[model samples]
Target: MGGRLPLFRDLLPRGLLGRSVLIILVPILLLQAVALQLFYGGHLDVISRRLAGGVAGDVAMLVELLQRETIEDRSWIFREASWRLDLALAFEAGARLNAVERRASMPLLPLEEDLNRALEERLRLPFDTDWQSDPRSVIIRVQTPDGVLHVEAPRKRLFTATLYLFVIWLVGSALLLSAVAVVFMKNQVRAIRRLAGAAEAFGLGRDIGTIKPEGAAEVRQAAQAFNRMQDRIRRFVGQRTDMLAGISHDLRTPLTRMRLALAMLPRSADTEEDLSALTADVEEMERMIAAYLAFARGEGTEQAAPADLVELVQEVAAKARRSGATVEVVAPSGLMLPLRADALRRCLGNLLDNARRHGRLIMVAVDTVSRGEPGDEAAPAWAQITVDDDGPGIPAAGREAAFRPFASGAPGGTGLGLAIARDIVRAHGGEIALEQSPLGGLRARLRLPV
Candidate 1:
């Protein structure tokens, strides 16, 4: 039963709109089918049988009348039967009923069965019905003691038009109800779709603003909740950024004063080496302060926009090359995706800088890849970028810890490079990870949705 549940779910529609429509249509169709069975299967059957019986009774009465009347008078009887009973009759003298070809019965239609049963009960003689002989009539040949009697009964007499009318009414109502359900459900689903799209864009650091509430009461309530959540998060981020900016200013001022004091210090051969070491320490402190500020600022209020990732990778690679690193880039001409350009640049810059600082040979490559099951067309694709180098790579166990702030693994490093990179990448709804590179060093991989 558990295994079958998955198969049942797989057969159902995936979208809410489709499922909603199915929810409405299934019951309606089933009801119509039941109504059809009750009406056509029961009431219509009785009506058909009655009508067939009346026709058979008429044919039986005419056969009895012809047997009693003389051959000359039979022409008048047939003429009267045509005008009064709506039946055409012809007498075949000395003709055998066995010679007439019998037509195949239509099992699906109850008309043939009802008519045949009625004729058998009424005539009490050998008779065959030809439903296919004429479209408008059913040919019935009866064996009389004198000869074979040919009777053509109007097909309409054996069935009521109410059967067709009932079916059409059922179908028409079902169609009308289905159309109304689709229109109403589509409007409701549209509102939900808008809410989802807005949430996705906001997650990717694109400010889509608040979405207007529409649709049902529940959906509207959810949208309102989402708007409230967005407002709260934005306000929180704004407050944090403002606080960080003030701290950066206060810290930089003291560092600036310290640099001036160090510059004014009297220099001598003995103190020169100590002064140089002090200067390097101050510079390192400044670098650490900058790294801290960058880490705290994050993507920094940058709105996402469509940017060519390939061009960005090449630009970062060119910058790395100028900084005395041998950088090789392999990427397609254009791979555009929504991004906070400066934030992503910083993210890539950090990865490349780390590589340049540790490794001599740097390799950058960008490509598109799918992270879904095989043959899944609707699976999302990502723009994948890898920065590889020939430097010493971090062990797999410590790679995850390297993303923490102040976790530098090398000398002259502030330890915030991987942390800042991961922060920026996550802000853009992407991921950054470190792995062993083919170049025998660390590989920093970034994947962003395309």
Candidate 2:
């Protein structure tokens, strides 16, 4: 039984809605089968016995009349029985009875045993049925004094059309009910589909709107819970960002004041170098504060829209070129993605700036790639953006450390560039991976879902 369970599971539907409908449909089908079995096995057997018994009495009377009659009288009886009772009778003078009954080797017809039992009790003679020969009628052979008495009776005397009607009605009603349930379930599950789609969009940092509760009671409760969760998460992120923004603003005030006071102080020739160094330290602090504020504020609630990803990457490459960085771009035209243009631009800007700062030569490649089974025509596509440069790449061991904010690794960087870029990429339902470039530097592979 355990071994067969997997086979049954494979036969079952794979979706929630399908499985739910199957839960309703399977029982109806099984019950219909049971009802059919009970009808045919018990009730129909009794009816067949009663029908066969009446026909047997008529066959026995005809047989008795023929046994005691002259040739002419037997001929009249055969004609009368054939007309009135749908019995075709013939006398073959020298035909041998089959040693084995046809029923022994043939497929069982409905109530075949009942017909044989009735005939054996009434006729009291050796007989063989032509179960193979006729379809619309049954031929009963009885060995009598005359010869082999051949009696051909309509098969309906033993098997009527009611059984066939019962099976047809049972199957047709089940099909009708299944179809109705499918349509009804589709409507019922619509709310669940909406709930899932809304949750997915929220995870990807898209706008989450108010969801109206629908479906069954349990399903409505789930939708309500999701709505509450969404509200709570938005509130939490908003509170943290607000707190950090306030902190970042307060920290910048003293650093700005210190810079102003230092500029105002009269510098001696001996102290000139120290003043410049102190000024540079103040500026670095300001930059760090700015990066922290940006990270805290998050890419802002940027609305996603369809934009040309190729154009977006080229724009970043163009900006890099303007900044005296050697930039090369290879991209297909008009490759659009549903994304936040500002957030993605900021992400690409950080990655490009990082590459240009480390390496003299930089390359940005953008294309839409399909991810699915090989040769599948309906595969979904991904927008791939890769930034490669000839700088000294971070080691495999330190690669993960590069994305941490203010981690001590690089000499001049605040260590927030990769972290900021990752936050933005993840918000757009994309992934950023760092690997050793073929150009002997860092390769930033940013894959965005289309």
Candidate 3:
């Protein structure tokens, strides 16, 4: 059943006008061919009878003239007068007689043999009535005062000229119609192809210049809709970025004043703890605000270029080592890939910081992954970067909520790290998730599409 499904489900639309033309033209051609058959068939019937009647009339009249001429003068019998009359009459009637006979006996016409037989029987009228059933020839009998005279003329095929004419008409019409359909289909497909390319460019975040509203009305409407959507997205993103930048600028001034004021506190024994606590609170507040600002103004937002994945991981690991954290880099391939460099750095930095804060050791593993099974669905080629730690892993149920802003599993933690990391990754068109690691701690996985 599965093997047969493709044969049954030929579900992709062939095209609009192509299918429509076929629906229209096929039946039209069939009907025309049928009408041609019927019309020619009638012509054959009429022509055959007319030709046979004309011939019979000529023979009767000629015979009557010959008898009278012979009676008038004895020399007329030996003078070949009948032959001369026949030659003269035949020259005049040749075209009409041949046309009728050919139409009557045309094999291409419907039931030609039966039609010929009927014509022969009808033309046997006052000429000579004795017609043979298995006739290859026309047998004529004339009653005379002396005895009876017998004349025989072979039968000939009818309707050849009509068949040749009809064949030319049918073939010529089909060729003309097919040529028209081919030209029309080609033009339509070209327009559709242009629209498809424009759509793909838009999806890839490239600026598509004004789309020409060509083709059918539906296609034009779709292009117009796409243009509107792109305009809206650009406006919204611009406004949001401006707002975030303004807020960050306004906030730093107060935090700077607070830091200056905290420095003026006395270092006395009785009140040292309270002063230290207050200073610590100020620093934490400043850190949280800075994190918020960083999240707001995402890295590489203004620029993106290709970078080497394995080298970037190694650089991050080196930075963590300098900061007194145990981090290792593992990569299967040294892949140079296109990415927003600063955004990727910020995402990886946040993960490394989180692991250092909560775990004994950090493992940064990088590899290429095929995200699904091979056959039924396409296995997407993706870069899989996993940051794992050796500590108490995040609980299964609570892992999903950890990426939300202000969601903290640890005490004295602001919970903005994972949230900011996920945001940065998403902005770069990648996905990040938390799962249990083999190291008995949280595994942060980032999958980036190529």
Candidate 4:
């Protein structure tokens, strides 16, 4: 039962619009089917039997009347039967009913069965019925002692026209109702789709202004809640950034004064070494302050826009080469996706700088890859960027720790490179991970949705 549930779900439509239409259509079809069964099986059956009985009784009465009269007198009886009863009759004297007993050929309704049963109850004589001989009438032959009595009875006497009209009404009403459901459901679903797209864009640091609620009441409420959440988040980030800006200004002023004082100190042989050490400490403090600010600011209010990843990788690699690193790039001609360019540049720079500082050979590669089966358009594709180096790689156990702030594995490092890189990548709705490279060093892999 558990296994079958998955199969049943797979067969159903996945989208909101398709599923909604199915929900409306299934019940309507079931109701129509039930109605058809009741009418065809019960009411229509009764009407057809009564109609067949009337036709059968008329034919039986005529046969009895002819048997009482002589051959010359029967001519007048036949004429009366034709005009009064609407039946065409022919009496063939000294002729036996020799034609084969014909059965109905795929009668659509119960008309044929009703007529045959009625004739048996009324006539109680050898007879045959040919339903296919005429499209508008039934041909019946009664084998009497004198000869064969042929009767052509109009089919209208044994069938009701209301059956066809009822079927058509059922089908037409179902179609009209289904169309209305689709139009209304599509509008509702469209509103939800807009909401989802807005949320995704906002997550990637793109400004998709507030959504205008247009769907059902529940959907309107959700949109209102989302707008409120966005406002709160923006306010919090603004406050934090303002506070950090003030701190940065205050700290830089003292560091500037300290550097000036150290420069003005008198140069003496004994104090020169101590002065130099103090100067180096001040400079290190300055670098730490800058790193801290960068880490705290994150993506720094940069709006996401489409940019060529291949171009960005090449540009970063060029800078690495100028800084005396053997940087090699492998990427396609073009790959465009939404990104905060400067933030991403800093991210790539940090990874490349770390590799250059520790390793001799730096390798950068970029490509697009699917997160699902090939040719599955529903699955997302990712722009994959990999940076590999030949330096000694961190062990598997310590790789995760390297992404923490102030967890530098190398000496004289700020330790926020990996942390900052991960922060920026996550802001762009992408992921960054550290792993062992084939080059016997660390590999930093970034996967950004395309």
lDDT of 2 by residue, 1-450 (tens): 999999999999898889989899889989998998898888888899998898788888888998899776677898899889888888887677767645542244456777789999999988877666777877888888657888888877877788889989998999899889988899778988999989889887877777999988988999999999999988988998989888888998999899999999899999899999999999988887877788877785888999988888888889888998999998886787888998888889988889988898998888877778777759987789899999998899988888888774556677888998889888888888999999999999999999
Checking candidate 4 for backbone clashes, the offending pairs are none
Q: Which candidate is the best by TM-score?
A: 1
Any idea what lDDT model 2 has? 0.85
Q: Rank the candidates by TM-score, best first.
A: 1, 4, 2, 3
lDDT of 3 at 178: 76
Best by lDDT: 4
| Superposition TM-score, candidate 3 onto the true structure | 0.59
Candidate lDDT scores, in order, read 0.88, 0.85, 0.67, 0.90
Off by over 4 Å in 1: 97-108, 371-380
How far residue 70's Cα lies from its native spot in candidate 3, in Å, is 34
* Runs off by more than 4 Å, candidate 3: 1-7, 10-214, 297-300, 375-380, 411-414, 427-429
Name the weakest run of 10 consecutive residues (lDDT summed) in model 3.
90-99
Residue range 1-450, candidate 1, lDDT tens digits:
999999999999999999999999999999999998998789988898899999999998998899889998888889999999999998898988885565555565588888889889999999988988798889999998888899999988887889779979998999999999999999999999999999977776677888999999999999999999999988888887788778877888988888898899999999999988988888888788777877776775788888988888888888888889899999988998987888888888889999998899999999978879887778999889999999988999999999999898788998888898888888777888899999999999999878
Residue pairs with colliding backbones in model 3 are 101-158, 102-158, 102-159, 103-158, 103-159, 105-158
User: How accurate locally is residue 255 in candidate 2, as Cα lDDT from 0 to 100?
Assistant: 93
Q: Candidate 2 regions off by >4 Å?
A: 1-11, 45-50, 53-57, 74-156, 160-165, 180-184, 257-272
- Candidate 4 achieves a global lDDT of 0.90
